[model samples]
Target: MTIIKNPVIPGMAPDPSIICVDERYYIATSTFHWTPGIQLFESKDLANWQLVGYALNNEEVNLRGTNTPAGIWAPHLSYDPQTKRFWLAYSHMVNMAGREFNADSYAIWATDIRGPWSEPIYFTSIGFDPALFHDEDGRHYLTILEWETREGYQAPGHIVLAEIDLPSGKLLSPWHRVTQGFTTRGCAEAPQIYKHQGAYFLLLASGGTGYAHGVEVGRAETIFGPYEAHPSGEPILTSSPRHLFSLGDPDAGHFEMVNPHSVMQKAGHGSLVHTHTDEWFMAHLMARPLEGQLLNPLGREASIQRMHWTEDNWLEMEDGSNLAKMTFKGLAGVPIDNEPNTDLFDSFQEPQYLLEFMTPYRQQHQSWVSTQKRQGFLRIYGGNSLFSQMNPAIMATRATSFTYEVETLLEFQPNHYSQTAGLGLYYDSNNWLYAHVTYSEEKRCPYLTLLQAKLGQRIEYVNTRVIVPEGNIQLKIGYDHGIANVYYRLEEQETWQILLQDLSVAYLSDEGVNGMPGEIGGFTGLFTFIGAVDAHQHQSYADFAYYKVTNHSPAS
Candidate 1:
C-alpha cells in the first residue's frame, strides 16, 4: 500500500468540512478576510486534492473591512441524499473587540457542489461555527456554539442544538444546551452531529486553535437530550499530546502548547468521512512552523488520517493512539498517481485562471484584472493602494512551504511614485514586504526599490536601488525559513542583482505579530503576490508574462 502524506491540503486552508457524493469527495474550508468566500477542493482519492471552485462568489455578503480571523468562520458542508442538494452553514464575524464577539450566521444551498449556490438565508447571530445536519427522519437540525459572556462562567461557550426549517431558515425549536466539551480542553466550538448504529455523535474542536488544539467526541441516543463524554478524558486526535497547563486561557497566542518534537502543530477542528471500502478518515486542520519556530506562517492547514472503530463503537486512530501521524496507509485498490502538492506555474495563456489565485476582501473586479485583454499576459489595472480593502490590484497565491521561491516577469510603466507594481510578501495590508519598480525622484527615471509595511506604516529602504531600462524585468523572492531575499534583473541581463537579502519576514505570521489586544497576529498566512498600487490616479496597469512558485523542501 502507498503511504499517504498528512496535510492533504496545505497553506491557510483551515476548519475543513468534508462530504462524499457517489464515491467522490469534496472539502470546504474557511477563507477569512479573503475574497471568493469559501474555498472548495475536490479529491477522488483522499490523498490528492485540487481546488475546484468557491461557494460564495457573488455579493451575498460584504466582507469589506473584515478584521483578521474574523470574516468567514468555520463552514460546514452537508449533503441531503433525498433532495440531491448540498447545504453550507457559516458565520460572518463582524467584530471581536474587547472579547465581545458579534457575528451573523447564514446558510446557502446548491444542487451541484460547483454551484450556482442560492443567496444566503439568514440563520442566527447567537454564536459562531454553525453546522447543519439533515437527520434520517427528514428533520433538519442546526448545531452551534452558544457564546456566553457572564462573569465567572465557562469562558468561550457551550455547544447548543436547535431544529430549523431549511427552506425559511427559521428555528422550529428552542435552543438546547449540549455538553460544554468532552474534556477540559475548553474553547469548544465547531460543533457537528452525525449518527451511526442508533446513536448520535457530536464532534467538536476543543483546546482552541493553537498548539493544544484537538478534536473531541460525545454521543447521545436522541437528537438533543443528555450527551455523555467519551470514556477517555482526552482528545481523540492531536499533534501536540502534552497537557495544556493554560487550558482556560483565551489568548490566541498559546505559545505554551508548542510541541517541538512534532513537525505539524495546531492539529484539530476535524470533519470525518468514510470511503467506499468502509474505511474511516478525518480531514482536520494542522500547521507546520519554521524548523525551530512556534510561529506558523502558513496558518492552520487541512490534514487527514486513517481510523477505525472500537468494539464498543468508539472511534480511535488505526494505530490505537490519539496522536496524529505524518503518513498513513493508502486505501486498497485506489492507486491515485498524483500526490498532494500545490506548486504553481501560471503562464496566463489560458482563457481562465487557476483557482489557487485569490484576492483580498472584495470580489475580483474584471475591470481591474483579466487575461483576455492581453493574450499571453495578465493585465492588472491599478486602483486603490495595497492597504485598501475595496479594490486593490493584487492577485496572490498561498505560500505553502517555508523554503520556496516565487518569481514573475513583469512589464510596467509608472509615471508617478503612487503607481508602483511588482512582487510582494503580503500578510494583510498592515504587514508586508514589497520590492517593486517605481519612479525614483532622485534618479528621475524608473528604478527598483524595497519597501516594508509594519502595522500599516510604510518604510522605504534607501540603500537598495537599481536603475532599469524600459522593458520586461524578472523579479524573484526566495524565502528560506524566516529570511527573505529579493532579486531582480532586466531581460537582457543574465545575472540577477540582489535588491535585498536576509530580510526577516518572521513577523508576518500568526504569532510573531498581532492585531487587537485579544486578536492574534492574523489567521491569514503569508501570500506571494503581484500587486499594483495607484493612489494618484487609476490609470496605471501592470502586465505579468508569467508567475511561478517552487517549493524547496525535499518532500515537495
Candidate 2:
C-alpha cells in the first residue's frame, strides 16, 4: 500500500468539498477574502493535485470591503448525473459584525468542471456553508447551518435541510431541523450528505475549527428527521480526540486545545468520496503549525484520509481510530509520486500569469501589473497601499511551509515616500509585514524600510531604515516558524544584511490576529508576494527581475 501524507493540499485550502466524477477527483475549497474565489484542484490518484481552475473568476460579487474571515465561506461542488450538469453552492459572507452573520448563499451550474459556469442563482440568506445533494431519484436537497443567535440556545447553530429547486433558486419545502450534533462537541457547520446501502448519512464539522475540530456522522432512513447519532457518540475523525474542552464552546482559538504532539491541527470540515477501487476517502481541512507553536500562519489546509465502513454501517478511519494520523496507507498498490509542498520561482518570463496567482478584493489590472511593460521583468505600477482593499498592485502566491524564504530582485525608483515596492508576508489588508524600498526624505536618497500591520494598525520601523544605491536590489524575507526576518543585499553574491530580525510576527497567524474576540482569528493564511504603493498619482513603477521561494530549516 502506498502512504499518503496528511495534507495533500496545503496553504489556506480549507473547507474542502470533494467529488469523484467518473475516474477523476476534484476538490473545491474556500477562498475567504481572496478574489477569483472557490479554488478548484484536480487529482488523478488523490495523491497528487493540480490547480486546474476556479469556479468564480468573473465578477459575480464584489469583495472590495470584505472583512477578515468574511468574504467567501464554505464552497460545495457536486454533479447531477440526471441533469448532466455540475452544481456548485457557496456563500458570500458579507458581514459578521456583532456575530450576526450576514451571508448570501448561491448556486451555479455548468456542463463541465472548468466553467463557463452559469450566473449565481441566489438561494437563501438563512445561514452560510450551503451544500447541494442530488438524490438518485432526481431530487435536489440543500443542507446548511441554522445559525443560532439566541442567548441560551444551542450556542452556535443546528444543521437544517430543505428541498431546493435549482433553476429558480426557490425552496420547495420548509426546512427540516436535523441533529444539533452527533456528539456533545458543539459548534457544528458545513453539513454534507451522502447515501450508502439503504440509508442517508449526514456528515458535519464539529468541535469548532480549533484543535478540537473533527468530523461527525449520523444516519437516517429518510433525508431529514430522526437521524441517529453514530454509536460511538464521538467524532468519526479528528486530530485531537482526547481533548474535551471544546464541548459547547463557540469561541475560536481555544489555543489551549491544540494538540502539541501532531503536526496537523484543526482537522475537520470534511467531504467524502469512494474511489474507483471501491476504497473510501475523505477530504477535510487541516493545519500545520510550526514546531512547538499552536499558531497556524499557513491557515487551514486540505488533507485526505482513508476511511472504511464497519459491519454495522458506521464510517470510521481505516486504521480504526478517531484521531487523525500523519501518514495513512494509500489506496493499496496504487503507485503515485510524492508531491512537494514547499517552494516556487517565477521569473516573470511568461506572457500572462498563472491562475494559481491571485489578487485581493479587486480584479488584476494590466495598467498596474503587466509583463509587456518590460521585456523580462514584471512591471508593477504602484497604486494604493496594501492597506486599501481596493486597487493595490500586489500579486501573491500561497505560502505552503512555515520555514521558508522568499526573495526577489527589484529595481524601484520611488519618487515620493508613498511610492514603495518590495516583498513580505500578508494575511490581509489589516495584517501584514512588508520590507520595502522607498524614498527617504531624511537620507536624501532611496532607503530600505520595514512596515508591519497587526490587527489593522500599521507601524513603520524607523530604526530599520538603510540607504541603498539606486539600481537592482535583492530583498529577502525569512519566515522561520513564527518570526520574520528581513534582509537585503546589493547583489546575489553579496552577503545578506539584516534590515530587521526576530520581528515576532507570529501574531500574523490565524489564532493571533483576530480583529474581534470570540470569533475566528482569520481564515486566510499568510501569503508571500511583491507589492507596491503609489499614493502619488500611481506614476511610479517597479520592475522585478525574479521571485523565488525555498524551504529551509527553521532557526532556534
Q: Please tell me which predicted candidate would have the highest lDDT against the true structure.
A: 1
lDDT per residue for candidate 2 within 1-556, as digits (tens), equals 8777767877879999998888889999988888788898988777778888888888887888788889989999999998889889999999887788989999989988988999999999988999999999888999998877878877677788999887788999999989744556788889999999989999989888887789989999999857889987889888887846355567655556677777778889989998877899999998877666667788888988889999989899988888787777776556786654546788889987656678888777687888899888989889788999888778888888768899999998876888899998888888898889998777667888889888889898887877776746899999887888889998644699988888788877787786455445787898888978899888999999988888784211
lDDT of each: 0.84, 0.84
Worst 10 residues of 1 by lDDT: 244-253
Model 1 over residues 1-556: C-alpha lDDT tens digits? 7788877777888999998888889999999888788999888888888888998898787888876767888999999988999999999999987777998999999998899999999999998999999999899999999887878776687789999998799999999998744556888889999887888989988888887888989888898958778787778898878766344555555667777788888889989887887888888998888877667788888888888888998888899888888888877788988756678999999978767888887778778889998999999888777777677778898888878999999998888888888998888867888888888767677888888987778788988888866836899999988899999989788998888899989887887665544346677788889978888889888999999999987332
Superposed on all Cα atoms, the candidates' RMSDs to the truth, in angstroms, are 1.7, 2.3
Q: TM-scores for all candidates?
A: 0.97, 0.95
Task: Write down the worst ten-residue block by lDDT for model 2.
Answer: 243-252
For model 2 the local lDDT of residue 194 reads 95
What global local distance difference test value does model 2 have? 0.84
Error of 1 at 442 (Å): 4.0
lDDT of 2 at 356: 68
